[model samples]
Target chain A: MGIRQVANTEAPALTAAVDVRDLWMAYRPDEWVLKGVNLRVPKGQLWVVMGPSGAGKTTLMKVLAGLLPFQRGTVEVMGFRLRGDLTPPSRRVVGYIPQQLGLVRGLTALENVLLGSLARHGGLGPTLGFFPRSEVTRAREYLEMLGLGDKAETRVFQLSGGERQRVAIARTLMQDPKLILADEFVSDLDLPRAARILETIRGLVRERGLTLVMNLHEIQLVQELADHVVVLKDGKIVYHGPAGTLEWSSFRALVEAEDGRTGVAGW
Target chain B: MAEPGSLAGKGRDVNLRRWQGLSGALALLAALGWVLGRMGFFEPGRLTGGLVNFGRFAAELFPPDLSVLPVVLGALIETVEMAFAGTFLGFLLSFPLGVLGTRTLFPRPVVLAVRLVVAVTRTVPSLLWAVIMVIVVGLGPLAGTLALAVYTVGYLAKLYAEILEGVDPEVIEAVRGLGARRHHLVRYVLWPESANTVLSQLLFMLEYNIRSSTVLGLVGAGGIGFYMQVYISTLAYSRLATVLLAVLVVVVVMDVLSAWARRHYLLDT
Candidate 1:
């Protein structure tokens, strides 16, 4: 009773943007992909989830995005608890950038970015491929912020991998969500390009006071940018702490341990 | 405990199967040849006689009856109208039926039922559909128009279903994550992704309906084919030639226009 009271007393010291408690998820019955996981991100911070292939990184992101239903425990994002019945928070509250970037290949970069503003305009105007002039101007501003102002009319299929990644970030920014979830959205780019894009995303997160949870394999970028880090292996959190506290050698050993046990490749 | 020559035995068995397959194919070919012979397909005298009769008929069809130009033009207009109305009506219904038929959008039972209906409708030829409509609507352009519309619904529904089903799943997931409703998916994802193919298919269907509408009038469904039936009954070969010429000209023009429209509006390049 004394410990419970103490825990309750300290709960208000930090406001949590994402609070996940004892979460369990699976695609099939009795075959768990995420066994037991707990995570917490402060109101305005960038958190990186790192793991080897098939370590439930993508699965965790999907759960947080409300794309997948969980079997056990509670997941609360932006103060609203996610329902076990697969109901998600309002789309305006959570922005998700999928692994493939999820930009419509046939649509222009501007149109794709404008898709982020869909939840804001519930009228028939946007439904018929029409957007308010102000929204269009804002979408252009987002593109310009991402250095894609010149290519706004270019189709997504015509854009390079790095360019496509920037467009996706712009789209997410246009969502005006308090929380952003990205799943390996930049693992394909070169060092310079990835860093440039990461800087843009990190800048926005700081300016807007948005909480970000991204899945990445790059320890260098994670060390440089992430405020907190969570290392997952086989659906379990092996390490969870502030980014500055974890040593690079120990983090590398934890990620590389599974490479010898299973034939799966690791970073 | 295996036989010493089992490998050799397997080789012989394979060779025997190959010989059996070759013999079966030869027997099928011989059967086909015998049927063709019985049907008089190789009779030289029958072929020569047919050619001679065709030549004589062709001789009489020349200098086609120019006096029937006004009649042929009016019938041509009616045929075009029927095709246009039918295509428009079919497009209106096809989009919804197509959406319902897609497995990605609806449940298995719903998709199966919609596909079954579309399949049964498609199984009946457009000409037969026109005949049925003529019986019900008492023989006019309305029957022809309804027939083409029904055929278009069956044809375009299946096409639209396949196109919608083929939309990139990742795009759909992303859009849904944005809190897009079903109508948003249709208008934004499905429609834009498949606009070129859908437009091309619609134009092709229009062209096909125009060509087929010429035959609807034979059943008194009000098109140029009515004049064809009249020409045949009255042995007016010259007038028949004129109608054929008009149909040929219209078909060529429709083909060219369809091609141009597809290139200009549908293709990205």
Candidate 2:
């Protein structure tokens, strides 16, 4: 299928959907979590961030999503430059799916998806539970697109893990985001399900020309789905290029390499 | 090569240690008994004498004077109204305080200030509050209602803050990531998730307030308790028995209703 570009007034004519330059972050004082990390992701591409356990893949995603504050460096996402603080206005064009699939267990799938348009319906609309019929219809359409039309009335607690993940994706899609950051969004799903989810994500990204950056541990899945690949090790970028450019053996070696040895345990 | 006498000596040492432990326990028990006796807790003479007098009074309480049934029912209805009004007011006031007190929503200083107010209010019992209100508001159901409302605000707010704090952080994180404001976080995420728990706690507080409101009138706060005091002072055992029976019936009905509400409405089951 040819790439379909939807004109967005919010996003400028910028090629890079995400651009990070020498980013640095730390949870504690002096000790850094991300040290001198840099990346540039073009629009309409599915990028995979591959790393071992505690290799700062999630941290980088948070920094890009404007969830975590950085001690140093610049981050530009969805045409907004982020220094440290993540203001609500700057976050409007982004959709973030956390590792745990943060769907409210008590709310139905439709209600959960409707929460994505909360910001759009500002004032007392959300507080009074008054959603315009158009927004509700759009939410249902997103669920239908995600193959959850029949399960719209089902509470999230009653859904399986894979189903919950799909619900989370539908919720994100309802946001109408320019960039989507997913952290291990399908790690719990089986191979066929994972492949199907990736396929759906790929189709959406291409159809809408939305940038997709996700953290994945499965190398074969990454090889099949990722248009671009970034490998992080000890808070540094070990590899960043087109996914097809690297051999499987070399990519494995790059991920397993231990460069910095401080005898510190993985976070 | 060990001597037989050495093993026997070890056994003797064990026996001595066991005896020491037993004596230590005995000393502790004796100390506890001496303290309790000094506090006048084990006075069998006064207890037996009081029981004999109470048995005489109990015989007089039978065949309760049905003549005062109407008056007793009116006071009983007033008591239920006080409990219901107090619990409703408390619930209304506690809702905002609970939301503001959550550390996830507010800063540490703000959360701490809200918690300090809740703690101070909760430190005083509802009966004590009624007494204080009686002094301030002066002898009526108004005093009882105000007392219960203040007391409920303290307890319910603390309970709500705890529930808000215990909510899964990831759920909040997801909402916040979507650019949801503070109010949205509360209205959409926190309240819906904790609604069942909050409803259950409210019902429990209502049941407890009903029982407590019955006694608020002893301080002239207005209820059957004032009539009870009057009957006892005038040595009117039959009237007092009628009042006690009315209270028993009201409390039982409230208990059953609250339990039903909890099971059928608040809980999933």
Candidate 3:
């Protein structure tokens, strides 16, 4: 209750860009996967949602991104309700770097990045595949910042997993989204590459004031990078507070205790 | 547990015995046919009469005629044009129909209906279509082209749906993640991932359509086959040989070009 008051009071001063309450989704009926889950994200803040497999962290991220629907909850992004059939407009503000780093292998890095602008611009810009110079420059700038500028013409299939993930991040960033959701995006990366992704998200959250919510398997990353940590188990919130406020041992114990509990199934 | 296991083992033995009986019956049918052939009961009686007429026919067709080459070439060009025009039309039309037929995207009933319709379309061969088309349009290259086009649509749409089914959904998910609308998803993501695969299939279909185009001419449609029919009817065997040679050359060229296209564009990273 004290934590809720603190978060609520902080919400207005800090950016309360995302508000999710009592969310539930079951791909199969009578088998509830996400049972009454809730979380709040202030704008310009970095929040990490951490849990083991089947913990519903990814599902929560999907719901936040407006990619998946929830039957029993209300989701408001940037003060807009993501409900009913209002998905297309709501999804416009939510940028996502999915865990699988969904890169199209047939296209080169530049073409893949250029595809981001297509969603907003539609076909009005260019009939041929050539995009506008400014849009191309922006894509180049993002790739350059990610150290992939030289590899712009390289096919996506030739890239390493970490490189592909960076490109995915660049694609999402191209949207200049109000809120960013990255779902276990760094799981396959080596430690250094993983750190790079985290740092990039950190800078995005702090400098650009973008609301960032990331699903993670790594508990330590919460302490190192997150302003707030929302720990989940069996599709329910186990803890939600400032990262510094939670006791590390107590959180670990709750996670360990969950292993003995009956598992939740739907993804 | 023991009785169940023994019962299962007995069931397996019975199944094997039944399969053995089927194979034995098939072998007996083959042996009976061979024995009949050995007894001269299945001799080439049809071939003997056909050959006697063919010998008399061949003697009159000779002194090779060069004057007919011009007419044959014109018909041959028309046939080639029909093949190209039909293949292009079919390839273009199949894209949207194939999307409708994809089970992943469509409801069960829609996919089933589309599948049933496409299946029925493929059953009517190009030659049969040429005959039906001739009834509508009167015998000409237009009938041949339209018939081949119909055949191409049947084949391309069916194969296109299968190729679409095999496309990796990961790419689609990525595009979906970007919040792309339906058209963009299909145009950018789906087409690119499956383009090479579709291109390879398209080349093979072109080659097949070319071969079928010749037969389309047999029903008074237009092509090398019309020439083959004409010279044969008029006892111009040498002219028939010339027409056959022209077709063989054109077919070989189309084959090489298709193969080259498949190599150049389809087999790449």
Candidate 4:
């Protein structure tokens, strides 16, 4: 595989929305999930992280989202340097969509979206279900933007898988975050729906000047949506470059060689 | 030597275990029989005498004295009020205690400390608690209500802890990631997710407290049981019968009402 490094000399470290240096994470002693990882995402760019199952894809996203505390690393997201502790940085800057979507199934779609804005409104009002009217309106606007305005009052468990995915996206957007870490966000959707959602997400990222690091198994979507791509294998990056110049055939072989089976077959 | 796959070695071990289990069961049976003999459970003379006394008592219980109906009804109302007030007070305290006792929410030391308090409180029956409260606070409905509330806190807090612990961890993690504090989690995620179960348990506790509070008055804690004590001491079996009948009807009614409320409002039909 030909690995071409994308050099953005014009965009310095100051422009990096996400920067990770020599990150190492382990759930237990000496059993590392992420090892010596380094990543830098420039402002207003969509980056896709692709790897085979259990290749530390989700782990990397968890560390970036400040959900998982790494043993050793420097993770700086939206100018907040993460301490090696359980205390996550400010919720206003980073929004994370886990693989399960991390939604409260009992909550309404609108209420779930409103959760994103709770950090902004301190004290007991938000905790007691009294969100400010302006924030509530903003949540509705996010839902409307994601085409879930009609289903705002519906419970998350009642919504369809695609609709739920859209709700997750809308909720993340409701946080008004400068950085988004979405792990397998569209993996549940069909190709067409995934494409539509990705397009919408890309448009939003561009318009809002947000930086996104999304983990995906769909090579086609990765090819289409990624401004840059970082291919991880066994807790380390094997390839990092522009999405346009990524050799798809070689990339597939590199990830699928160990399983000896094709995933998301040829296109 | 028996071959690795051969049943000879395994069969011998299995036979030995079976014999050990048989001996254990036989020993347990022998112990139970000895305890029963020691307790005079096998004495036919004592058993017949007890039955004869019970028959006479049963005969006296008939033709219940209706003259005390108004007085019994007033005492019954006091019993019901005591149960309500006690259970409400317990419900108030249980939320915080439950949160502290929840293993998922609190640290090991906090959970252990809260659990220890709950276990100690639950170890004493509500009747015993009423006796203590009566001595401490003087005889009244206040003593009975306080006793019931303390016992309710112990029982309900343990249950609430279990419910809080059983909430979906993923949802909690998600909310925590959104920079939610511990209290925020209880209010938004844990409470909403487990509301139905928690409410149903509360109603069941109320029902149980009602039954318990009826007996608290025997110890001068103020309820229908106080009247029961008076009649029993005076050998007024008919009057005792009236109080017993009233208690039975109220208990049955409460059971039905609680069941209906749980079904109609708390549970998902």
Candidate 5:
């Protein structure tokens, strides 16, 4: 069966791809990183989570990706309820892009992308570094989509920062995830490259009806690309509204005020 | 006489500090020398006598008897076979133990248990293991093979566990995030990433086993070392010289082969 068919069968009919309610997380006792975060991300739209450094944006992304365990929360991703432990089925439908890009430096772009189909190929084939011809073609196509067709055989370490990010995106795309969680996805790119990467991701989301939850630092890019914006401050959601309606100056003021109070500064 | 504020006074002060430091170092060295002397080190009589005996032994080893070439070759082959079989067997057995011993992949208890077994095995030297194996399996290559295999398992298992644990956490996390099971994580990410180091370690173990197996015969476990011990007891210096030459050639050959394998396989990766 195709990966999308399997994903569709696993995920029941739900309007919201991600449904997080009363989420509270802490890396240590007595220090809460995310405080009662409630979010409802509808399918097939780009939602950006923006905040200053240490505002728990990356923490929330990790929680959604099932990498971090929360103290108290109900996280539903791709219709599967994540209650501390993430099931294999839920993981198959959620793609995570970490801030470091998460690409193996020694592996070529094509080889890294081929790793995304590991779950679909039943583990053994991919483990042996063998991908079926169809999967190989699809991997190439994903690389091409991310504008890395020419550099498929290039080792990831040899690629520039922006190129490496594109390779990461291609790898994520190859997973055929129903929902994608990207942390600082374009933070390494130049203005034009960032715009291009975001446009490509936005196009793919619209075309494939994939849910995108991204943590972005660029205010202008967030405004330009985000369908909805959720502003976090001091482990709490300060604003959750449409990106177009939110004023940049007010959002910056709220972030700066929190930064001054905590002696932590970031745009 | 120079004024206190003059450059000459400063130079005198520097010289004074240097002299003090030099004297302190000299005193420390003298103390260490006295301690070493107390420990029976660097005795001129024994040192000169030992050097003279060593030179006589070296002179006797020259003009080695090539007449025993056939017997020496056979025993050398036996030693090589023992090392090969032992290393291969140990490598096969170490796989599961190494996987289980990895702290990142398995639970704490499982890792601890596996590591405990590895540590216990590692504590026993290969030659000591050969002595025990000689009692269990009787004399010959069988005992040597068994001893080497056991020792290799202990060493390689710990080495492999360390290599697996040293893999990039980011790569592992990425794979795990993609719904990879434990086996999948090991087979795809861990093994491929650490293949070069693993291969290099394996080659090193094989080389070590070869050198070790040659000595296993010293305990009647079978190899050129058995013949060497017999020759020494019998005062047959010529045959002992021949045996040592054979061992030197075999070790050199093994080293070359191992270096080639490491370069070809590991460097390419």
Candidate 6:
């Protein structure tokens, strides 16, 4: 297995940053959550998905990120097949942060950020509190970029909600991922903090020229950060076009229509 | 927004709640009475009283022989060691199996296989485990230690599964996003979050194991129970008083320690 993997990696063209076709997922047999979700985002493109609650917006991200197994679909991320009609641990190329931001509370910002990179490249990083200097330096740099340099050593549980979100984004960056999948990361933040988070994400997208497919409620955020906007409703794309065409009214209508179905449009 | 009709509906809901609560209280009292009746609780009370016999027994235990205090101390220490060794064995062994038994950690078949093994062990009482060990090891503290260790693993495995299941998956998602390996997840995320609850349970189990070891000794498993049995069988009321006092002191200390640990780790204020 090691020899074959090594031989295959010599030719990097074997991987695509993000690829999906005919993706279908239904937690229950009675209904499909994501009906034929066909999507493709090459390296360095920011794609934002907009939809009301239960429209399979978050489901699409998870399926593409290889977090959820689609009943019938093919997902290839960064040349690694996340789920090609089957589930596998395809976290090699993609960094996925879900809506709740599953950050470790006991760890510091630096440790968390360092952990992200260690997972991908493979190394015996840290056992106890002791850490190597090089990794610690990299972790501090990532936190500094997120405007959290002073708070790098601070435990995550001690941080504010906004600070945690920034640290989460920083941790994702630590992977040096070709693609980032954020599922409604800004829904928990206030309007100003949400704007800051979007700016932080946009800077990362621009700097790395990476593909970012995020599921978010704020259409305004998409207009600001996304290159393309895909709106889904009832497991189907109702609107797919440039972010320039989106307006408050159409997005609001989708929200009002599905008001009773789910509590919020944010994943 | 709900309409005025919903508010009127809420009035009906309040009435329904009242009726349910009243009926539930009556049902509980009746069930208790029925169970007590089945147990023949009242029949024993109707029989002749033994107030005088009780007084004599109470007198016999008191003015206890303080001469055997050293012997009592040694037995008490053995009981503590038994509890310590048992809890340590249980905690360490159950840790990995608990992680395996968690559906969120391992695959379904893997979890099921481990669960079957745990269920078999849990079905038997700790005292039975002691008896089995006694047969093999032959009358010693080693038998009591083995029994409680097995008992601890069974009890902790079940509890650990529930605690692992109840862990904040959000934290898991955080580390997984960074692409932490399974071992990484366990060390960084699982160990920290579950440590408090697990510690509290360990302390409680330690207290229980100490008490259990004393009882297990009655069956030739070993520990202070042999002395207790001797006192009982020989009618050595004075030595029995010494043994009882030693057991009581140890139990009180264990309870106090358990409470202190809970307050320190759990309430965290």
TM-score, one value per model: 0.86, 0.87, 0.82, 0.86, 0.85, 0.87
Model 2 lDDT tens row, A110-132:
99999988768778987788788
Q: What is the DockQ (computed on Cα atoms) for candidate 1?
A: 0.50
The candidate scoring highest on TM-score is 2
Q: Write the per-residue lDDT of candidate 3 for residues B93-148, one digit (tens) a residue.
A: 87777877876567889888887888888999889989998999998988888888
> What is the docking quality class of candidate 2?
medium
lDDT of each: 0.87, 0.86, 0.77, 0.86, 0.84, 0.78
lDDT of 4 by residue, A162-259 (tens): 89888888888888888888999888889999899889888988899888899987878888889888888888777777776666687877776664
Mind giving the per-residue lDDT tens digits that candidate 3 earns over A177-259?
A: 87888888999987777887788768866877788888876666767788888778888887777776656676777688945
Error of 4 at B128 (Å): 1.6
Per model, state how many residue pairs clash.
0, 0, 1, 0, 0, 7
> Which lDDT value does model 2 have at A225?
89
Q: Candidates 1 and 6: which is better by lDDT?
A: 1
Question: Residue by residue across A5-76, what tens digits does model 5's lDDT show?
Answer: 123343443468888999999989979998888888888878998888998999898888888788897877
Candidate 6: residue A126 Cα off by (Å): 4.7
What DockQ results do all the predictions give, each relative to the true complex?
A: 0.50, 0.49, 0.39, 0.47, 0.41, 0.47
Off-target runs (Cα >4 Å) in candidate 4 are A1-14, A188-196, A241-252, A256-267, B1-38, B42-53, B267-269
Q: Which candidate number would show the highest lDDT if scored against the true structure? A: 1
Q: Which whole-number lDDT from 0 to 100 does residue B26 have in model 5?
A: 100
- Please tell me how candidate 4 rates in CAPRI terms: acceptable
Clashing pairs in 4: none
Off by over 4 Å in 1: A1-13, A244-252, A256-267, B1-59
lDDT of 3 at A150: 92
What is the DockQ (computed on Cα atoms) for candidate 4? 0.47
lDDT of 6 by residue, A150-173 (tens): 998788878899999988888888
True contacts kept of 6: 0.61
